[model samples]
Target: MDQPVYSAAAPRILIVDSSRNNLAVLARRLGAEGYRVMVAETATTALGELQRVPVDLLIADLALPLMSGTELTRVVRRELAWRDLPVILISGRSEADGVVRALAAGADDVVVKPFHFEVLTARIARLLERSTRVRQLAADNATLDERVVRRAIELGEARDRLKALEAELGRVG
Candidate 1:
């Protein structure tokens, strides 16, 4: 879609899957594609990594040993800061059920397992691009907020000065 948004610093992706083999495969693939990969074998570790570093994208597999990807998405979305973060849920379960659950839990997209590396990479790129745009919009909003606040303060000061001058003139009169 949009030209791939290239950055000097590779985008970070947090992959949470209990299967060590799956984690390794995903890490290798993403790393080769220029993404900084972070692996977590459990939901706890994934949440901790999120706290320590804001990841560009999250790819989590349902049917994890202790915690499912759905649960992870719920926790992340509940937190105000991570609510808008893009999540891609991977599952080997029934596609319909898994997709519905992932969406309910706040995943941006869901991918069934037995996926091709190229397909996954394309999806990752799309998510990264979307996230980038969202972040840019947030930055723009913050800039506008700052400007509005500054202007409001300036106007208030000017009004105060005007009132003071009027009081002085009244006394003089």
Candidate 2:
């Protein structure tokens, strides 16, 4: 009998861009590079996509149709606090204020338009790696918390039994 082996799925990237060309090109390129790509032309649709499927990373255009990527990042950061999703905002503008605002709004990284695909890919990898580390740390913390609680409960039970034993000895003597 042969045992079944499970393989990891490719990382899923959700890209929100109002431009059809941007969405199409990125989906094609990223998919070719072995990433499962999901594209949305608007932030609202991007939110819907998030609800429908689990995404590893988000690459959003700064200038979306109904909502800007900054706004979208804020909403995702707030509403999906448990998910801790990594967000990258790509924009045509290079102003320092715009970059600062996006970061303040919870974007993990920002990429300027006409970016090299290699650089974008590197950023995605870094963000995903960081996110993975964070999740691992959180899981470790939860396990530690459970162990502490279990130990405390055991200590309490032992103390209770000790008291009962003392009472029995007192009555016997």
Model 1, 1-173: lDDT tens digits are 23334355888899999889999989877777778889999999999999999788999998777778999999999998898888998988666977898898899888887878789889889888988899899999999999999999999999999999999999999
- Model 1 / residue 45 / CA error / Å: 1.6
lDDT scores of the candidates, listed in order? 0.88, 0.89
Candidate 1 structure lDDT: 0.88
lDDT of 2 by residue, 1-173 (tens): 33223235778899999999989989888877778888999999999999899888999999887789999998998885524899999989788888899999989999997799999999999999998999899999999999999999999999999999999999999
> Candidate 2: what lDDT?
0.89
Candidate whose TM-score is highest: 2
Task: State residue 14's C-alpha deviation in candidate 2, in Å.
Answer: 0.3
